[model samples]
Target chain A: MPEHESPIVTVDIVLLTLEDEQLKVTLMERTKEPFAGRLALPGGYVHTNTDQNGDDAARRIMTTKLGFAPSHMEQLETISGPTRDPRGWSVSIVYVALISREALASHSAIPLHLYPVAALPELAFDHNKIVRRAVERLRSKGTYSTLPCHLLPARFSIPQMHHVFELVLGVPLNRTSFTRKVSEMGILELAGKEPAAGRGRTAAQYRLKEEVSFFHRPLGDGM
Target chain B: MPEHESPIVTVDIVLLTLEDEQLKVTLMERTKEPFAGRLALPGGYVHTNTDQNGDDAARRIMTTKLGFAPSHMEQLETISGPTRDPRGWSVSIVYVALISREALASHSAIPLHLYPVAALPELAFDHNKIVRRAVERLRSKGTYSTLPCHLLPARFSIPQMHHVFELVLGVPLNRTSFTRKVSEMGILELAGKEPAAGRGRTAAQYRLKEEVSFFHRPLGDGM
Candidate 1:
């Protein structure tokens, strides 16, 4: 391949969380051309000198652009084509990250706009497709993995955790069935605490045993 | 990024199939430096002039090197690092492809070697890691999708298909339960045929419905 034909490699991250009972993704305004001033995922070029790989680049971009590390991160997909970027044949190693709403509220230095996954605005450089793919991956994995825990606070009640899963999965889960299935997975342990007063009946708080766990069976019958 | 620092982009394919009741992958002897005379996955540089994207490059490499198109192909992962390729900073868009064993027998012109997934030889570059990731993805997805069909003939009996799944999953499935679960999925149709003489009991032939099916529930219990 000629020098001019070399593809520009970049990493794009779709950071997702549940805010106001809606599944939202973080977007930043691009300051450079090729779609200047448009909303885009937090990303940048793969620094050959300072970064070791795409994962490193993604983490660096997240910390530098968002000012916080995500609780959960995984490579979603690689979007590459001739027309994805106007500059040249570029490839974007896309990733999906999850952060708790409380964490996002505490770290408010970065000027990021949260948009509902269903009602995302016009994004820059085929980012809409990238975000869609990430959402699908998140929901698909949510069925068998304890990925929803990352979208909640460290200690949360069963109802709060169920709400996060329902929002991300776009379905209402029965409270009894949800609690039973989640408890049966053996990934969550009672924190031996309760919510503050005036929050209706005091629901027992639970915390994820570990970061994530893949269940041998699906959490529910189907989404 | 400067022109000299441009990353060398390529596509490496992990083509898997069942051979002698063992899950095997295809590897070729490298004829160039950076692991010459060693076993490596079939790969080539992404043709900026002829190929549109990594998918196109993967298919092109398959047809040229393996002389057949895979029944199923999907992007596995993109491995990029400064030390992965001894030449320079390079990125390889890896993919996983599956073709029936019968197809491999018919198109046996290429000088390729088959190695079982259990016991693999020293592979060139980080191909061992790439192949491992592909196997993980295959097994993970095999639980809910009709992915094993790609590793069998176009038309096969239920028992033959069950055998393929058992070999790939490394578990013996109960015939009664396996048939019931597969039938409940509604992803297979009778081919109105049976195997020729000399085979075991005459079993009804079946083919995968369309190409593939993603079962809402797992086809069977945990492997």
Candidate 2:
């Protein structure tokens, strides 16, 4: 392909967070064509002159568009095609970013627009397809990893973690097994104690040992 | 970026298969400038006009370069940088493909130059780093999924599947436990009995119901 017809390459990020027990993705109105003024994932053309690589492009986009970095980010898949972007053939190295509600709230002044994953407005380009793949990755990884933990506060009680799993997996887990399984993974450490809940009962708070962890066993079994 | 400064975009594939119980990756002698005589992963510039998407580009390359299509292929990740290719900025959608030794033997006329992954030559560009990530993914997925089974013949004995896991994960697993776990996953069906071993006892051959299946539990616990 000639220089003028070089595949229009870019990077797009699906920044996801849980708001009031509902999973949401941040979107912004496109500031330029091919869909100016329409909602789309935060993204831009790769700065071949400045950006070192795809990861750098993702970090730069997050900083410039979202105002805050996600605690957890991963390359979900690269979305490419002739029709994805109206400007000739284009490619987007799509990524998924996870922010806890607490983390998201800390930057509330940015006025980020979030829409539920289950019910998204028709987004610009192939963004809706990109978001679905991101969710699929989240759900698939959630079955055996502490990935959803990124959806909770930096410090959270056991029940808070349990509730997030149920919300994301759409299945109720027995509380005792959930606690034991998480404990066995050894990905969490006791951080402190939560202020008393109803009935004046205090719950223990914990912090993840890492950004994410995959369990030896899927949470679906024996839960 | 100006038309003349457009980034060079391409796709590279890391085609891996097992040979004599050893993990090997396919490479071809580079036929172009920058690394004309060096062996590198089979790759080419993406046909922006003819290829519809990344997957399509991958397929076209497989057919044109290898002549035989792989039974298992996936988008591992996209690698990009200014210096990866001598020709300006470039992006390559790296893919990993798995082929059974049996399948590869059938296409012996292709004269493929496969190198053991454990001991690789100095590959062109960042191809070595790309190979390392592909191996990492294969190892991680081997722990919980029947991914390594792709290294076996389409119809294989139970012990053949178990040995491939051991080779890929670099861990020995108890036979009874491996059998029980695989049975529970329900991803394989008995195809036929293998020719009798030295003891004059035939072993059952099984065919994977799908290309791969993840077990609810890792093959790490219990005998």
* CA-lDDT, candidates in order: 0.79, 0.80
lDDT of 2 by residue, B44-117 (tens): 87788798888778878877898866646788878887888888889888888887877887964577888999
Best by DockQ: 2
Clashing pairs in 2: none
Which regions in candidate 2 have their CA more than 4 angstroms from the true location?
A: A1-4, A198-200, A211-223, B1-4, B198-200, B211-223
Error of 1 at A168 (Å): 1.6
Candidate 1 interface RMSD, angstroms, 1 decimal: 8.6
**Fraction of native Cα contacts kept in each candidate?**
0.50, 0.57
Candidate 2 lDDT, A76-113, residue by residue in tens: 77777788777888888887878787788896558899
User: Ten consecutive residues with minimal summed lDDT in candidate 2 chain B?
Assistant: B214-223
Docking class of 2: acceptable
TM-score per candidate: 0.88, 0.92
- Model 1 residue A65 distance off true place after TM-score fit, in angstroms: 1.0
What is every candidate's alpha-carbon RMSD to the true fold? Answer: 6.1, 6.4
List clashing residue pairs in candidate 1: none
